[model samples]
Target: MLEKKRVQQLDIPSREGYDAIFNSNFLEDVPAALAQWGSSRVLLVSSKTLAAQHGDRIAALQSALGSHRLANTKLGVGSHSPYADVRDIARRVQRLRADCVISVGGCSYSDACKAACLLAANLAPDFTEEDMEALVDERRGIADARPEDGTPLRPRACRLVAVPTSLSAGEWNALSSATNARTGKKQHFGGWEGGGQPDLILLDPELAAATSPERLWLSSGVRCVDHCVELMCNPESAEGRCEGLHGHAERGLRCMLGGLTEYKAAKTRARGAGEKQQQQQGTQEEKEEAGDKERQLLLEGVSECQYGSREALTGLLIWRVPMGPSHAIGHQLGAVANVMHGVRLLATPSPSPHSRALISFKTRPVSNLTLPPLQITSCVMLAPVLRWQAANLSNPHYKTAQAKTLAIFNETLGWREASAADAVERFVRSLGLPTTLRDVGVVSDEEVRRIADKTMTDVWGGGKRQMEFDDVMEVLNSVRG
Candidate 1:
């Protein structure tokens, strides 16, 4: 916190740069992605809901595989990336000897496929439950170990092509989350060491734009907002002065916020057109063109995410940055309580009555935090610095590599008079997302403690910011209402 000057550092992962195709017609490039992997036998993992929505398009992509075959399509991936679901999928992959996996869905489905890819490569084709449990636990321990000591177990190498249909940005990350069978805790595993990163990520805005507005867009869009927030406030970003990847984070946040606003307007325009078409019968060609135009607008918005979010993701996958409190708590909520990742991020849900009292008792702030004392202290003391930066949006320093992030809040978001958190909350509200813990489901006080403990102890990249027990309770209390 006291360092007046520090060495500037930024790491761009060699493997982070993957082939990405961002277009409404991104499915057309799936065969090409598979061909690049030299995959003759491909296995596609998607949700039943998605398959039903775009069955014809998926089928056409399979046909486009030309002589190369699509071994099978598994359309049943449960939410939260359950361990059982991953195990079952791995069995099919091993039996089919699939050379490539095309994961198509939101965060959970994408995470499930990544875990399946790892399990299939490392474990025997017909491993038992005990074997799976042991391997998972081992990985968890190794992941939690100190950086120098923990070398994640590598999985069987299989090319994965991701076709993201939401804004969760899991497709952009290497870490895959799955619940522990025994403890029922959501666990983070897989990274560069484990070879769990996808080979190609296909961002089909047409596909993403066509998803459930409430289910996919609201939750995942906030998840994207969380990403931007973390990057903006990350210790490495150093109050937006560090020109390395911090600049990318700044540009990314601006782009995503602007894109989100445009996307909402496009949806409005598209909905009105649909009503008009219903009243005055429209031709098939006209309908297709209208759909294409809507998709193009959506694609434009999501395209901004690829730049800033990509840098954040790369840092996370390589352990260059630490997961923040919201993320840590979200993981625990998903794992222990069976909540969806995006839902947990948006709202914490109330704890059980008994647990509520327990949480209430622990709501008082602690005199000191556990680790990174200087950093945490710096965080509390840096408010004035941040307020000053936000105040002077036109400072010469703002025109550097990373755009004026505060200006974006003031201009793009109409948050000229709002605090950062307030501005973010307004955005979440506009998207119809939950703003408190009680909105989703009931959590027990025990669950609150469990989440806090696990968050501090669990090992996923975000070392700079972690929540102490008191800190976690304060956050939980603030949002519990």
Candidate 2:
């Protein structure tokens, strides 16, 4: 497994020429950058929430980049992506004659951007809501793929640019994941050609730092684990194939771990202690330097869309990443439970009856000495969420466990992972996050049973990993314990 080119290495910058475009205003130089990209008319893919929070950010674009047409697509993706969301984005991109696109907000918004680019760039023939319906049912990859002009061919040309407000590493992956409204299913699209790795990508940590700590932590946790597993899964995942403590991989590993350490220390003091925000707070230069280090450390496939339109003409391919168990399983749990994606990593859920995530132990082997789990996680991790009381079901369980699920989320501290279910409850309590099923809603004995059975189904997982009904029983039982 260490030698196999898994999927975790695809999120890095392909080249070293990207000039990060970042400004505290969120309105500074982005619009002008969009206008100057190329002859390709720019299309903006964004949501209501993002526009509202940073209305000036979008408006600034219109005023500065009057050189392009704009389009809007809305779907917060905290829950799921409807097929209509995809179609809406696609239709809008075509309407504006947008040659280039910019996505704003969370990973979901970014997904919308990718799908829009694919649809319009490829000119895929319109398959009514019903046509895609049939395709969704078939247990296979894309089939009957054809062009919109009645000709079956790939896309003509169009590019994508992403500006993520959350720490979702997907922004750096070669894959695009979204939920289909019509089919009520989650889908993954993988290939290469989809314009340049964004004619330009602007990753402003300020934007990411603004995200809810829950989201930041969850997303970064997923990425941290992916790096760990990927390094072992693909021995070449680090610095062109150097091994031991003497290579670039080791140095990169050190920085990531260092970041995690600082992250944890800051989180430990966030609870009722009153001294929060310390974990993510920073001066201007610190933020810029952090952003730079982040760019260099990411895999070499996906890059920040900071470069002008140069390499885009070379046919955008070769952008891929290798990921393993912690990632895939984490995805299944997040999609099914509607929880923050990274929380799944801390939870380490077992699939339902049908889904058994059996990993071949012999596949990839690495000693703890080479990789320090605690240091790596504590460093790169984001500030945790604190607010809910554990037992207050209707509110967040930042204090107790028997109450609610997604109560009042105070985006500030980190929640540690506890061993037993009780410990889990306590750990979440310390971070001010919900700790029980009742906190979010479902509580009664019958409700718990139903939750167990439903979790076992994991219908949205697309059978990628089957967790039987009994597994659901275990999870529910553990929560109670």
Candidate 3:
């Protein structure tokens, strides 16, 4: 049995880079924490939405840092960490001569900041687009890149501090991905070295709860689930070299499943109570009290989910386990089709158009009634890929890993079923998320081919067996609705 200790204000250890502070109340704790870092000049990067939502807190932070110390504030970072935005941020870092970067947002913003700092530290003062392209093409990440004199690159000039508003868990690693606007492809950057990682990570569940959308928060939890499941089920993990990491993966799986289940139940109960109160005409004071209570319950769940994300990411980063095809293909989908990272494909319409239309009539404009196509989260792809491994890989280690994964699922989720894939699908459905590819906006055959081709280029694309185009296509078809 796993220990049931709750993390309140713990410092999570990284393998090589960065320090993590968990359960921090950002506004209350950050100023004092920043004092320890002793960074005089700090550049704050975030999206406009986050900036608007937390304006008061931001103002307090700025006052704490002082006008001269807070070098520049850059907002309006787009999704996928576009290359152009990275370049712009890099130039700002260079121009301002900022000693520290504090990125306050989700994974993409953190990634953009990491890449920008790397570019500023390594590239020329006037590096061009072609230069950036050459860097990615050569795959000379932070670890490998060197100066022309053949000496080691200087220790990173700027330090990064990440305050994550979503559960994507990008703050834990030095690696990052940036979308190339010219080629419309997501390019990977950074390695397990140097200045690409954050010097400090501030995790506050209340801040996350206030900033993230409900769907996004929940779905990103599922992404963490993907992290644990892939690690537990990877064939290479069965080898003696990384056997200990499985304990982390199992513990992480339990935390994620339990937390997500509790969150969904609490949300359902809160919504039901809200509707009942509305119908019965509760007093304003009573309603406010009830709202506060509901918010606390949700915060509890979010806190657990955050811990779960930490555990899962720790396992992945500590040993540098290669993730399965779901991650590889999902990266392509995000780059090529503009799919959000945590999206799950629903085989059928969710809430139905008729129900959405009614809700829209009551609360929103008719123009907002149209629903977009559903794209499956990488978590949804994990089960089918596991099954594919069971069938194809003839190695005893693969079989052993597959059986252990199924046992973990059965033990954790109380499932008697034999197939791990089906168990995952059921769990996703329980979360009100869908599972299929046809819902990914009517993907053409050519587009499907493109996604598969791009998957080949990813470092972790095919897992241990090195899946080819046909193998990738087979897995895609299984989840293609």
Best by TM-score: 3
**Winner by TM-score between candidate 2 and candidate 1:** 1
User: In model 3, where do residues sit more than 4 Å from their true spots?
Assistant: 1-17, 137-143, 146-155, 280-293, 341-376, 463-465
Error of 3 at 97 (Å): 0.7
Judging by TM-score, tell me the better candidate of 2 and 3: 3
- Per-residue C-alpha lDDT of model 2 across residues 1-481, encoded as one tens digit per residue: 0011112122334533333343223355466555566544666666556566656656765666564355443434333444566666766677766666677766566665665555555544463444433333134433224424334334425656667654443454444665554333455543443332344455554454443244244334334423432333232223343323122222332333333333434444333223333456777687667555543333111112111111111111232223322233334333444333222223323222211221111112223211101111211111111111122113222223211111111111132323112222232333233334322222357644544443332322112332345544444444431
Quote the positional error of residue 208 for candidate 2 in Å: 2.8
Q: Largest lDDT belongs to which candidate?
A: 3
User: Which order, best to worst by lDDT?
Assistant: 3, 1, 2
- TM-score head-to-head 1 vs 3, winner: 3
lDDT of each: 0.57, 0.39, 0.68
Poorest lDDT segment (10 consecutive residues) of candidate 3: 354-363
Candidate 3 TM-score over all chains jointly: 0.84
TM-scores for the candidates: 0.75, 0.54, 0.84
Tens digit per residue, CA lDDT, model 1, 1-481:
0111111112444554455555525556777666666788888887566667668766666678664568888886666777888888889889888888888777777888887887787778778655655554443322312244454565656788877766677776666777775776676656544356677777665566664343355456556556655555545545443445555555656666777677777777877987888787768898888877776776676555544445545444444555455666666655665443223222223332211111111122233222110001111112222333344435444233123444566687766533554455555555444444444443577866676566665554212343356665656655554
